[model samples]
Target: MKRYAKAVWHGSGKDGSGHLTTQSEALEKNNYSFTSRFTSTAGTNPEELLAAAHAGCFTMKLSFVLDEAGYYPERLETTAYISFENGAITASRLFVAGIVKGISLVDFEACVLEAKVDCPVSMALNIAITTEASLTD
Candidate 1:
């Protein structure tokens, strides 16, 4: 299966504005600009989208890993922090919290590690990927 998104940009890099659209149309001509990317402007940027993808992918992969390890999570939450430096992405840090019955914290952490390394998005990204996981009652 293949997924695709489209970006349309106009003008110079610093002064240009763009809109993004996904195949699913979840983002239909969403706006992005230099200020939105470089400063605290109200718009979406590529890093933000990538972070969302990473977080979603990691959490889903963790759920599968937990299931395979015989642990059913009542809830799982993950936040992916993408760091962009020197005009490139430097790292993705994942913070995850899960509530799963009958699972030790150590085991939960192991599962998180496995998912962190095995998620498609993590594998696709060339930057450093680190994770911090906690098991919550």
Candidate 2:
């Protein structure tokens, strides 16, 4: 399956504004601007979108990995931080809290690692990526 989002920008770099539209229109004309990206603003930005994608992908991958390992996950919560600096995206950090049945901490950590490497968004990103995984009841 292939997916794509389109963006259109108007005006100069620092003063320009843009909106992103996805094929399914789930994010319809999501506005973004230099202020939104570089400073706090009332609109969505690319970095936040990346963070969302990374978090969703990693969590989904972790669930699959756990199931394949003969474990059932009761809950999994993931947060992703995307860092942008010097005109480049520098890093992505994933924090995962997991609760599962029939898995040791060591094996749960191994599953988390596998998800970190195998998730599509993680694989697509060229920047440094790290993950912190914890198993909690």
Candidate 3:
């Protein structure tokens, strides 16, 4: 149950560039550079990847939580915003929307809160994690 990724960097930090490859090949040799990370350059960065991971993890966990609560979701969408400050990750904010049949908004929010805290990625992070969840019709 272990996952791994590889990063290969060249040159100095500011002037250097790197490529990342994941075990699943989902990000095979994706380029990342200082400009890509610090500016609006079109490339992938660690924070972006972490955000995707968090969103995916949280959504999946929410699905499980809903199932355990005897509710099946028709759809779930989540976006994770990762905040970086002072060379550290400060927070992860999750915005989620779910469409489930026969579930109250309060119950859906409770499931979202449980998933936000119980997800693997959320538990692994040592930063603030907040969620804004909405149950849709």
Candidate 4:
């Protein structure tokens, strides 16, 4: 199976701006600019989009792990941060918290580690990936 996405950039990187549209169109012609990334702005940016994608992908992978372990988590919350520096993306951190009905900590840790290494997005990213997982009532 193959999946693909496309991005089009126009104008200069510093003073000018561009829009990003994905194959899914979830971000149809969304706006991006240097200020939105380097400074503070009210529009979207590459890091933000990457964070969203990582969080969603990690959560989905965790769900599959939970199902496979017969735990069936009640809730899985994940936050992903992508760090960019020197005009390059450097690292990604994934924080996950969940409430599960019948899973031991040992089992959960094992599953989380497996997902961290095996998740599709994790494989796609070309930077360091770190994860922290916790179980909450």
The lDDT values for all models are: 0.96, 0.93, 0.95, 0.86
lDDT of 1 by residue, 8-83 (tens): 9999999999999999999999999999999999889999999999999999999999999998999999999999
Candidate 3 accuracy as lDDT: 0.95
lDDT of 3 at 79: 92
TM-score, each model?
0.98, 0.94, 0.98, 0.90
Q: For model 2, what is the error of residue 18's alpha carbon versus the real structure, in angstroms, after optimal superposition? A: 1.3
Instruction: Write down the RMSD of candidate 2 (Cα, Å).
Output: 1.1
Model 3 CA lDDT for position 67 = 99
Cα error, candidate 1, residue 91 (Å): 0.3
User: Where in model 2 is the C-alpha error above 4 Å?
Assistant: none
Where does candidate 3 stray beyond 4 Å? none
Better of 2 and 4 by lDDT: 2
Candidate 3 pairs with clashing backbones: none
- Tens-place lDDT digits, model 3, residues 1-137: 99999999999999999999999999999999999999999889999999999999999999999999999999999999999999999999999999999998899999999999899999999999999988778
lDDT, model 2, position 19: 94
